[model samples]
Target: MKIISPCRVHMGLIDMNGSVGRIDGGIGATLDYPNCEIVGKESNEIEIEFSSSISNKTAEEDLKALYNRMYTSANNILNKIGQTGISLKLKEVIPAHTGLGSGTQVSLSTGKLTSSIYGYNLDAYSIAQLTGRGGTSGIGVSGFEYGGFIVDGGHTFGRNAEKIDYKPSSASKNVKTAPLLFRHNFDWDVVLTIPKIPVEEQVADKKEVDIFKKFCPVPEIDVNRFCRLVLMKMMPAIIENNMKSFGECINEIQGLGFKGAEVQLQKSTLKNLLIHLQNISYSGLSSFGPTIYSLGDKKEIIEYSNEFFDREGLEGDIIISKGNNTGYKLI
Candidate 1:
């Protein structure tokens, strides 16, 4: 069985960590874009073969840890339940360390497919919980379960709520991750530009989150101000096909996210490349590091990017991606 999970770019992030007793913010939207693919092939012994293009960028120990974790997690989940020994080979395409959630995608897909192949009958939510790959925010898990244009409820997941686990639970039994509420409502098209640069995640970990709680323990406001930027500004604009709102928000969020996560950002040729694009784009920094997503009309984006490249000599691989509605799925 094989599973492929697409990646996403967050438009605007709001610090909703106040509710969860943490400091991580809530994201406005997750645009479907580049995705990571994983394949699970059952084998006789307890052996797993992992091959991924992003492995070139993944730290050796981390890579081993990821594989070991998945293998052990899967074995524990399935074998203990049914004694089914399964083998997996991870086939990856999405670039890693670019803030594309490559690791989460791979892990989510692997878990989903493994469950399906063994006929364990695990639902999508259960699949996400079983993997522990999308904790950065439930949106990734939500995206894994659903697809395009979604807002995973915050504060709930961060509260150590058993309901949010990928595995099935009583609290979240009938939850569907897809856009069932608005099946044909939203069309999201995003252009993903990945410059071969290192990017790191910029968020407070568990420990840091604790420190944040200590420093800033305030009441939870409606966050309407921030949501205004997303819903009143970006959402309506997207529905109406407005470019200005999209660009403004996109550019602004990128810059803010960059400033928030500079220390862990891996080195890349992005800043220099951005110069060529600046004149023509509302580009901003993407998750963790080196992937910059530019939001604009399809024509304008192409036009400006080409103009910048030709006129200013910018070089890097660019992927023109349409907003993905398919979040995570098994094939």
Candidate 2:
């Protein structure tokens, strides 16, 4: 069995105030390019192979730890379904820690492949829970399950609730999944500006957790504005396929607390690039980003990025991708 999972661009967190008892509301859309494709078969023991080299930018120990985590998660899931062993070949993978939701896409792909090959009928939601994902935001899982523009209602908040603190998925202990609040098939092309920054400069693990802890419980008014933007502007634009309105709304999202914090922590070069793009297009940072996504004419965005790189004497990967309206599939 083989599974191809689309990657997602996280827009921003809608609310973390927990004032109304829920937190981590998020918005995102799936992209057709930069996907994780896995092929697997039954075997005597757990094994995984990669089609191409894992990113040279990632450290060896970090790569080993990532593979181990995925293997262990898949092993546990397969064991629960009475399957003994499996061999997986990673036909393709998204870049890790680049704010493209690589971990969830890879994990969900592995879980789905294991379940399907062994005759288990596990939905993506169950697979997410079993694989221990979707704790922070449902957008990734929802994109894997239903693809397109997605909004998650997030988790309930309190001292003993499913989630109380703002943390990365790796540190989340809750077994609960964020609920999908809204979805729509988005028909627009996204130009991704992926900067190849040094691993040390990138934010992940402890630094990510610290950022969430320090900046969360953002002011209530900012949360309210995020809510208003999504409910009144973003959703309507998506539903009506109003590209201009959608872009306008997206341009304003980074001002919200969650992505706002990420922006503040980003490297100066990335910060400048984001500002430059904003002058000519609607662009926003993705996750804890060095990746900025712009929605507009594909050719114009590409030409603009190329010009920017030349003018600034900088280099990075630029990709043009369309929205993935359909979820993952078996091939």
Candidate 3:
């Protein structure tokens, strides 16, 4: 069995305050380019291999982490079904820790393939639950299940709630995938610029936890404004295919609520790049990103991103992608 899953761009987290009884609401869209593809078959013993397509270009640390996730995810599903051993091959991958939600995609894809190979049918949510993903954001899980523009309702907050504190998905394991409130086929062009940065600047593991601890419980007023923008402005623009309004919302989101804090933590070069892109079109940093995305004018955005990278003597990937209306495919 083979599974191919699309990657996603997490626009932002909404309602970090959780004052209104929910927390960790998310808005994002699935992307067509830079996806995860894996094939699995029954084997006497567990095994994993990455195709030359990925092995040649992927970083050593990223390859190690991806290998571990595949091994662990396969084991989790195998244990669940009272089965063991599968030969897995990774044909392609989304780069990790660039604010593109690569971890969730890797885990879910591995789990799903393992379950299918063992004749144990499992849905994306079930795989997510078994593999402990979608703790804080539903975009990755939902993106794997049903693609396009998505808005998740988030988890119940306060004492004895689905989530009691503000945390990223990696740190909020075992939390159920949030309820998906809205989904639409997002047709706008998406330009992604992933700038190369040092490992220390890539936020993950303990750094992500500490960042959440230090800058959470964002002001209630900011959360309220964030909600209004999503509900009134962003959603409407998508339904109407208004790129201008949608881009405006993306630009505004960068300076509001939890997203504002996330942007504050970025390096000066990334900050300047975001400002430069905003001047050209509607742009925002995806998650805790060195990955900046702009909506509309794909040609102009890609050209400028290349120029910016050249001027700064930085290196990375620039991709032109569109929303994936269909989720993962099986063959």
Candidate 4:
């Protein structure tokens, strides 16, 4: 069996303040490129192989981490289903820690393939629970199950709530994936620019945890404004296919609530690049990004991003992708 899972761009986290008794709501869309593809077959013991092509683009440390994640997820699923093992081959993978939600896609793909090999079919949410994903944002898990523009309702907050503290997905294990509030097929063009930065410089694991601690519980006012934008502007634009309004909302989101904090935390160069893109077109940082995305004017944005990279002497990849209306495919 083979499973291909699409990558996602997490627009932002909503309601970090949690004053309204819910927190960690998120908005994001699934991308058609930079996906995770894995094939699996029954085996007496677990085995994993990576395509040689993957080495040219993915860093050595990232490959190791991917291997470990696949192995651990496969093992966990196998134990859950009372199965022994499976041989898996990774044909393609999303780049790790680039704010593309690679970790969740990889884990869910691994667990799903392992479960299928044993004739145990499970949904993304179930696999997410088994694999300890969907803790902080439901966007990744929801993207895996239902593609396109998505808004998750988030978890309950306050004392004895589903989540009491502000945390990223990695640190919030055992939390159920949030409920899906809305989903629409997004037809706008998406341009992704991933800046190649050192692993230490990128936020992940402990660094992500620390960042959350430093800037969380953002002001309630920003949270309220962010929610209004999403409800009144963003959602309506998607439904009506109003590119201008959608782009405007995307631009505004960068400076509101937890997302604003995330954008403020970017390194000077990346932060400046985000500003540069925003000036030319609508753009926002995807999660704790080195991957910044812009909506509309694909040609102009790609050309400008190349120019910016050249001017800065930076190394990275620029991709043109569209929303995937369908989630993962099984073949």
Candidate 5:
């Protein structure tokens, strides 16, 4: 069995304050490029091989922890089903720690392949829970389940809520997957620019937790406006295929609370690049990003980006990918 999973670009965190009755509201979509592909079949024991198509990259030591996490998740699922033998090969991987939901995609892909090789019927959400994902934002999980433009209704507030801390999904464990409030087939071509930057600048783990601790409990007013932009503007624009309105909402999102703070935390170069790109096309930072994505005319955006990169003497990977309407597939 082989599973191919879509990569996602997290537009931004919509709401962090549970004041509106939910803790996290997020928006993102799955991309057709830079996907993770896993091929596996029954074996005497679990054996795994991993590689990537991005620049002919191999899984580095940095990915070891993630690899182990996926293995453990798959093992747990296999144990539940009384099956334990498989040989897994990761043919391609979305670049990790770039806010493209690499971990979730890999883990879910592992779980699905393992389950299928063992003759077990499993859904992606269950695969997510078993793999310890979808804690705060369901964007990644939703992207895995049914690819498209997605908005997740976050966890409910109060003491008994499963989410006690504001942290990234990697640090979050044992939380219910957020509900999918909206999904629409998005047909825009997204241009993704991933700048090469030092590892220290990429927000994750402790730094991510600190950012949340200091900046979270985002003001309700900002949250409300964000909701309005997503609900009243973005969703409608997506349905109507109005790129202008959709692009406008994408530009305005950074001014909102959590997204605003995230932008504030970005390095000066990245911050400038975001502004520069948004001027010509609809652009936003993808999750703790060094990856800035723009959605609009593919040809125009790519041409503009090529000119801008040369003009600014900047170097990065630029990929043009379409939004995925159907989720992960087994081939």
Candidate 6:
């Protein structure tokens, strides 16, 4: 089976620091940028190949570890499913690091493909239970399921997917599930800044927020809050075409994310870049470090970026795209 999944962006993400139980905690998340892609191929033998503008030129020290990320990620999935005997293949256009959710996309995509290899007899969440890919940020996993402007309710605890607990299994009753997956329309457009450097490191990944190990979102944000922020605020802005309010909401989300102080936004050369471009509307840095964005400037953000990059003598790539209201696909 050849499965492809798109990457997802968290406009505003709040790490719980593992405060709530497996089912209870305050949840804070927002769509940062637009998306990423995950492409997978199930093979007879375990072989992995990856290519990006920077893959061939990663830092010498990071080379070995990078290879392991690609290799071990595959081995780990195949091995966990008793498919260690089989090898899987994956390819991506999103470069490693660079403030893009490359790693999450890669791992969850691998998990999805591995599950598909199991003939869908197993669900992605089950694989997640084994691999821990969608513990907090299941949006990427949801994106893998079906790309779109989504309000992903990251998983809550469940009993091995066995319905024995749903109701007393009187006289050997049958339990089945048809989990309804939903994706909403998001109207915002975003400008993606592909910085020159390849394999940009994540500033916050180093701090390692294991908050999920301690807390859950049952206490904080839930479907209702998600609906308000996403539907009431985010969706209306996107639909009504309110760019400024949309921009402000995105900015507000980022501010909330920094409250823990664990999500670091180390300064980049873009400091002056952001200052100079501040006059223009719709833009901010995604995640942490590298790839500063000028969101929702569809008409001519590309041309503006070129002129600014030329003026600053900084090389960058401009991706004029909107929220992909669908998931990943392969050509």
Instruction: Choose the strongest candidate by lDDT.
Output: 4
User: Stretches of candidate 3 above 4 Å error?
Assistant: none
Rank all candidate structures by their lDDT, best first, as comma-separated numbers. 4, 3, 2, 5, 1, 6
Model 5: residues with Cα > 4 Å off, grouped in runs: 52-56, 311-313
- TM-score attained by model 2: 0.96
For model 6, residues 1-331, the per-residue Cα lDDT tens digits are 5555544454433323213212211221223233333345556766655445445655655545545555655676677666653454443334455555566566555666665666555455554454445444455555555555444433233555322111110111222211323455554656676657533444434233333222223234432343355556765665676767666655544334332221333445565555444456555555443665566455566776788788768776776555555454433
Each prediction's Cα RMSD? 6.3, 1.5, 1.1, 1.0, 1.7, 8.3
Give the least accurate 10-residue stretch of model 5, judged by summed lDDT.
51-60
- For model 1, what is the C-alpha lDDT against the true structure? 0.54
For residues 142-207, could you state the per-residue lDDT of candidate 1 as single tens digits?
A: 666666665444333434542232221112333333212221123655556664432233332443
lDDT of each: 0.54, 0.85, 0.90, 0.91, 0.84, 0.48
lDDT per residue (tens digit) for residues 1-331 in model 3: 8999998999999988877899989999999888999998999778999999788988888899899999988888988998869999999888888898888998999998888877777999999998989999999999999999999999999999998887888899779999999999987778999998899888888998888889889999999899999999999999999999888999998999889988989989999999999999899999899899888788899999999999999999999988898888888
What's the ranking of the predictions by TM-score, best on top?
4, 3, 2, 5, 1, 6
Please give the lDDT score at residue 123 for candidate 5: 87
RMSD of 3: 1.1
Model 4 spans > 4 angstroms off: none
Worst 10 residues of 4 by lDDT: 52-61
Tens digits of lDDT, candidate 4, 243-283: 88988988998999889988888889999999999988899
Where does candidate 3 have its weakest 10-residue lDDT segment?
112-121
Query: Each prediction's TM-score against the native?
Result: 0.70, 0.96, 0.97, 0.98, 0.95, 0.67
- Any runs in candidate 1 off by more than 4 Å, and if so which? 16-25, 28-33, 51-66, 156-188, 198-224, 254-279, 297-316
N/CA/C clash count, model 1: 16
Error of 2 at 26 (Å): 0.6
lDDT of 6 at 120: 50
What lDDT is obtained when candidate 4 is compared to the true structure? 0.91
**Clash list (residue pairs), candidate 4:** none
